[model samples]
Structure formats: C-alpha cells, structure tokens
Target: MHVPDGFINAPVSAAAGLAAAGAVAVSLRGARRELDDRTAPLAGLVAAFIFAVQMLNFPVAAGTSGHLLGGALAAILVGPHTGVLCISVVLLMQGVLFADGGLTALGVNITVMGAVTVLVAYGLFRGLVKVLPRSRRSVTVASFVASLVSVPAAAAAFTAIYAIGGTTDVPLSKVLTAMVGVHVLIGIGEAVITTATVGAVIAVRPDLVYGARGLAAPLKLRVGGELVDATPAPAPVEPVAARSTKKVWITGLATALVLAGFVSFYASASPDGLEKVAADQGIDKKAEEHAAADSPLADYGVSGLTDARLSGGLAGTIGVGGTVLVGTGVFWAVRRRRAGAPAPAERETV
Candidate 1:
C-alpha cells in the first residue's frame, strides 16, 4: 500500500526512512551477485512490468481494491535482492513523479511494500520449493502460495509499524483485523497474477527465472544396479551475444507498455486495501496532501489532455519508460561495480 504523508508521526517516519535506506544499501550489494550481463537488463524490465501491473487494481471487497505488490513475482522471476530494488524503484517513481504515494511516506511504502514483502515471499518460496517437487508446476505453486502469504505479512508489518507510530487513536486490534482481512482478499489476486506470470515465464525461458534455476536437476538412471546421472554435462557459459535477452526483454517491455498504456483504463477505481483500512480505522485522519498533488502527472494523468483515456495512457507510458530507464541504469551500475576492478579508494595508495 502507498502510505501517504502524516499517516505516521515524523519520528517513526524518519526511523523508517533509515531502515529503508539500510535495506536498499544491503540490497545493492546483494544484487551484485544476482545481476549478470543477461539478468541485469531483465531486472529493469521487471521493475517496469511491476509498475504497469500495479496500475490495474482489482476489486477485493465491495468498495476495496488491491493491486500487484510485485514482491513475490519479482523475486521469483529475478532474485530477492533485485526484487526489493525493483519495487523500491517503482515506489520512488510513483512518489516523486506520479504522486501516487507521498514523498514523506516513501520510506514507509518501501519498508512495507518492498522490503517486508520481498523477504517474506522469497523466504517462503524458497522453503516450499525445497520440500516440493522440482518441476515448473512446483515453482508456480510456490509462487502462488508465497504471494498469498506475503500480502498479509506486509499488512501485519504495517500494523506493527502503526501500533508504534500511528498518528491516530485507532485501536491496534481493529487496525490489524481490518488490514489483514482486506489484504488477505487482495492476496488472492496477487497469487493469481504471480502464478500466471511465473508459469508463463517458466514455460518460455526457465533459465531466466532466478528461483527456477537448478530446480530440476539431471535425472538419474539405474545402470548395473547403480544410479548414474542421465543428463549431459553442463556446457560452458555462453557468450554475451549468444546469451542476450533481446527478444525476451523486448516482449516483456511491450507487454508492460500495453498493460499500462491501455489496459489500466479498465482497472477498478475503488480505494485499495490500505486506503480503505485507513479510512475505516481513522488511520487517515491526519493524512496530509501529497507534495506533488498539483504536478501535471499527479494522479496518473497528463496535464493538458482532456480525454481521460488519453491522459492516463500518456502518463502510464511515461511512467513505464521512466521506470525502465532508471531501473536499468541502477542495475547496470550495480553489475558493473561487481565486474570492475577495485576502486582507487579501496586500493593501496602510494
């Protein structure tokens, strides 16, 4: 959920900002191991796709809706560290450019929506995959379950945070119940989206799926009463050209653009889980207006476009493009840091 300003007191918000910063710093280092030449670019596409899908909010209750948090989906497709960065990037873009989330509450959104969700989902997914069969179906199943749990877990995290730094006098029990209850419904939608997306990717290019890697080891066959590996030995790493993800990246980016630029128009207009919970529980009593509320792109609409469809479409397209550019730049920089020689500062100076 995109926490707006004043929902949490300034002190708690500042603490969360420090936590978010620390998480991002740790993720950047961890992502170096996850992002390679081929996967680095895919990380950007993941962020763009998450940004797009988040626009298509589906109805959860009569007046409540929810959208893809993208933690599980991103973690399953890429890796957890990169997944956190992907969502952090999207939240940042939405806060600064789109005004969907408040700038002051950026850390709250990042902590709850990015760090918590990714950690819970990735941990659960990894655990489930270890106990289940090592097939594509198993991976999809894990993705679904992991996604389902992550939403409520994030809700719980928010509840804990609010219990400590809430700006309103709402009862902690009420907040927890409402938040968890609505988000559980939202989790179903999250599960469906994550499962379908992960399944599709696994069907096409399992190699690109970080979680699915090494899932299905070489089968063994019994020979002369002894079991032996049936699959051929692994081949050497492919060249950068041979391993390029041009086709997949292009296809994913096109899908994101289509979803955001067009399909987002049909998404539900109701308040999402957090918004509904806040309004009902009085957690939003002190909510402040977004700093960018008057911006041209605020509320996901172009400044001059009168047509609702055209305005939203242009805004969505711009968001996708910006997210890709920024995400790719960040991920590429992280990858290069991993590949480049030691910095002069770290080297022994004469």
Candidate 2:
C-alpha cells in the first residue's frame, strides 16, 4: 500500500527513508548480477507491465479493490534484486508524476511494497520450487503461493510500521486484523494473476524467465541399462536474447499496452484494501496534501482532458511509457556495469 504523507510521524518516516535508500543501494549492486543484455530491457518491460496492471484494480471485497503488487510476479520472471528495483521505479513514478503515493512516504512504500514483498515472495518461491516437482506446473504453483503469501506479509509489515510510527491512537491489534483480513482476500487475486502470467511465459519462452531457467533442461531418458541426457552437447555460448526473446518481449509490451490503455477503464472504482482500512480505522485523519497534488497528471488524469475515460487512458499510457524509459535506462546502466570494461584488460608494458 502507498502510505500517504502525514500517516507516520516525521522521525519514523525519516528512518524508513534511510532504510529504503540502503535497500535500494544494495539492490542496485545485486541487480548487476541478475540483469544481462537481454533481461535488462526485459526488466524495464516488466516494470512497465507492472505499472499497467496495477492500474487495473480488481474488486476483492464489497468495497475493497486490489491490484498487482508486482513483487512476486517480477521476482518470478526476473530476479529478486531486479524485482525490487522494478517496484521501486514504479512507486517513484507514481509518487512524483501521478501523485498516487506520497513523496514523504516513498520510503515506506518501497520498504513494504518493494523490499519486503520481493524478498519474502522470492525466498518462498525458491524454497517451494526446490521441494516441488521440477516442472513448469510446479513453478506456476510456487508462484501462486508465493504471491498469495506476500500480500498479507506486506499488510503485516505495514502494520508494524504503523505501530511504530502511526499518527493515530488506534489499537494495533484492530489494525493488524483488518489489514490482514482484507489483504488475504486481495492475495487470492494476486495468486491468480501471478500464476496465469507466469504460466503463460513459461509456456512460451521459458528461457526469458529468470526463475524458470534450469527448470526446463532437456528431459533425460533411459538408454539400454542406464539413463542418458536427451540433448546433444552444448554449442558455443550465444546471447541470451534470441529471436524468441524479441517475440516474447514484443508480445508482453503489447499486452501491457492493451491492459493499461483500454482494459483499465473497466477496473473496479472501489477503494483498495489499504485505503478502506485507513478510512475505517481513522488512520488517514492527518493525511497531508501530496507534494505533487498540483501536477497536471495528478490522480491519473490529464489536466485539460475532458473525457474521463480518455484522460485516464492517456495518463496510463504515459505512465507506462515513462516507467519503461526510466527503468530501461537504469537497468541498462546496471547491465553495463556488470559487463564492466567490455574490452579485455591490457597487459602492463613492463
């Protein structure tokens, strides 16, 4: 959940800010190992896709809606470090440009929604995959369960953060129950979306999926009295991004565009779990005005756009484009850093 400004005291908020900054710094370094020439751009596309799907909030309860947190999905498709960066980039964009989250609460959003979700979901996913059958179905199942758990975990994390820094006098027990209760329902939706998306990608280009790698090795078979590898010996190394990579990338981008540009119009208009909880629990009483409240694209609508649908559509499109551009740039830089000093090191001319 995107914590608005003033929900937490300045001291706790500042502490969260420092924690988020450190986490991001570590992720940047770790992502260098995760992203390559091929996945670097894919990472950007993943961020864009997450941004798009998050716009399509689905109704969870009677008046509570939920959207893709993208942490589990991204961690499954890419790697955990990159996944954290992906959500962070989306949060940054939403905060600065769309006023969806508070600038002051950026740290809280990143810590809860980005760092905690990615770490917890990815860890569970890895553990499950190790014990489950080594098949695509297992991967999808693991993804679903990991995503399902991650939502409530995030809810608990937010509750903890609030307990430490909440501006209101509400009892922590009530807040914990309500947050986890609604979010568990939201987690179901998260599981469905994560499973379906990961299943689709695994069906097509499993190589493009970071977590699915090594899971689809050539099937071994019995020969005579012994088992043998079915595939021939490997050839010279090639770039990870092949023709199929382009196809999958393009397809994913197109799907994201369709979802954000048109499908989002039908999304539920009800408040999300966190918003509803905040209102019901009086956690939002001291919510201050967003720093970007006066921005032209505030609230996911253009300033001069007359048609609500058209304005929202344009905003979503722009958000996707912006997230993709910025995310790609960041990932590309990380990748470049990974392939450091591309040229061979020169020998000393002694």
Candidate 3:
C-alpha cells in the first residue's frame, strides 16, 4: 500500500523512516551475500517487472482493486534481501516520478510494503518449502500461500502503524477489520500473480529461481538391503553459452514493457485496497497533496498529453526503464562489494 502524506503524524512517520532506513542498510549488506553474476542483473529486471505488474490492478470487490505487491515473487525469484530492495526501488520510483505515493510517506510505504512483506513472505515461503515435497510444483504452491499471507500481513502492519500515528479519529478496530477484510480479497490476486510468475520461471530456468534451487531430489542407492543416500556425482561443467542469461533477461524485460506500456490500459480503474480503506475509514482526512504532484509524470501520465493511452503508455515505459537502470546499478554495486573488488571507477584509477 502506498501511504500518502499526513496520514501518519510526523513523529511516527519519522520513526518509521528510521526503521525503514535501518532495514535498507541491512538489506544492502545481506544482498552482497545473495547477488552474483547470474542474479545481480536479474534482480533489476524483477523490480521492473514488479513495477509493470503493479499497474495492472485487478478488481477485488465491487469498488476495490488490488495489484501485485511482488515481495513473495521477488523473494522466490531472487532472495529476501534483494526482494526488499526491489520493492523499495519500485516504491521510490513511483513516489518521486509518478507521484503515486507521497514523498513524506515514503518510509511508511517501504516499511509496510517492502520490509514487512518481504520478511513475512520469504520467511513463510522458506518454512513451507522445507516441509513440502521438494518439487517445482511445491515451490509454486509455497509461493502462492506466501504471497497470499504477505498482503494481509502488510495490511496488519499498516493498521498497527496507523493505530500509533493515524491522523484521524477512526476506531482502531474498524480500521483493522476493514483493512484486513479488503486485503484478504486482494491477497488472492497477489497469490495468482506470484504463483504464475514463479511457476513460469521455475519451468524455464529453475537455476535462476533462488527458492527453487536444490529442489531436485538427491540420488538414492540400495546398500545392504537398506536405501542410502548416494554420493553426489560431480556436476557437469556447463558451457558459457549454455549458462547465458541474456535470453531470459531480454524476454522478461520485453514482457514488462508490454505489460506496463499496453496491458495496463485495460486494468480496472477502481481504487486499490489501501485507497478504498483510507477513504472509507477517514484515514485520508488529513492527507496532503503529493510533493511531486507537479511532476510531468504525475498520476502515471505525461504532462500536457491529451491522449490518455499515449500519455500513460509513455510514462509506464519510462518508469520501467528508469527502475531497471537504477536497480541494476545498485545490485551490481552489491555484487562487486561481495567480490571484494573496487568499483569500476576505483579500479580504473588504481
């Protein structure tokens, strides 16, 4: 959920900002351990994909809609640390460029939509993967469940935050009930998107999917009339060409572009779960206008563009491009840090 300005008092918002900053700092370190040549670039694409998919909001209730939060999907595809960064990137882009989320509420959005969702979804996903059969289908199933739960978990997080810093006098119980109830329906949409995306990636390149790694059952042998674990054979050395991620990367980027640039036009126009709840629960009574409302790309449309399709489509494309660029740069830097090498500029000087 994109929390707008003035919804939370300054003190609580500042606290959340500190918490979100701490989480981002921790994730940057953790991501160094997770990012590699194969995953670093893909992580950027994942952020772009999340941004693209989020534009296609699906109807949840009569007047409410929902979109992919991307926490579970990213965690399943990359890793939790990287997933948090991905959602944070998307949120930042939306806030600063699209004016979709408020500048002052950036921390609240990141805490609820980025940190909380990734922690809950990834933690639950790992637990389910351990108990379930180690199969691709099981990974998809786990993803579905994890994503479904993450939405409500984020909703609850927002409710708790509001309870502490809400600007209005709405009843906590009413706000919680409404937020959780509406988001439960929204969670279904999140689950479907996560499951399909995870399943598709697992089918094509399971190695690229962090959650699906090591899913293949180990070999077994019969010894002395008892089945025993077989010694693992040395993995075959794959050719450089065979290990290339260019194809998948290109395909994924293309898919994201298509989704944001075109398919988003058909998405439901209904207010999303958070917006609906805020309006109904009086959470927006003191909501302030986005600081970036005057930006050319505000409201997901280009300035002075008459054609809705052209304006929105262009904005979406620009957003995808910008997210991929920024995300890739961040992840690549983390990968370099993990390798214990200086950045390109430093290396050049050395």
- Write model 1 residue lDDT over 286-306, tens digit each, in one string: 999999998899999999899
> Across residues 50-79, which tens digit of lDDT does each residue of candidate 3 receive?
999999999989999999888888888999
Q: Candidate 2 lDDT, tens digit per residue, 1-350?
A: 78899899999999999999999999999998898878999999999999999999999889899998889999989899999999999999999999988899999999999999999999999999999888888899999999999999999999999999999999899999999999999999999999999999888878778888887546688999888988867767765445446887788888888898889989999999999999999999999999999999999899999999999898989999999999999999999987874444442432
- Quality of model 2 by C-alpha lDDT: 0.91
Query: Could you tell me the lDDT of residue 218 within candidate 1?
Result: 74
State, as a TM-score between 0 and 1, how close model 1 is to the true structure.
0.95
Q: What is the TM-score of each candidate against the true structure?
A: 0.95, 0.94, 0.96
Error of 2 at 163 (Å): 0.3
Candidate 2 collision pairs: none
Q: What is the number of residue pairs that collide in model 1?
A: 0
Model 2, which residues run further than 4 Å from truth? 217-232, 235-244, 341-350
Clashes of 2: 0
Question: What is the full ranking by TM-score, best candidate first?
Answer: 3, 1, 2
Best by lDDT: 1
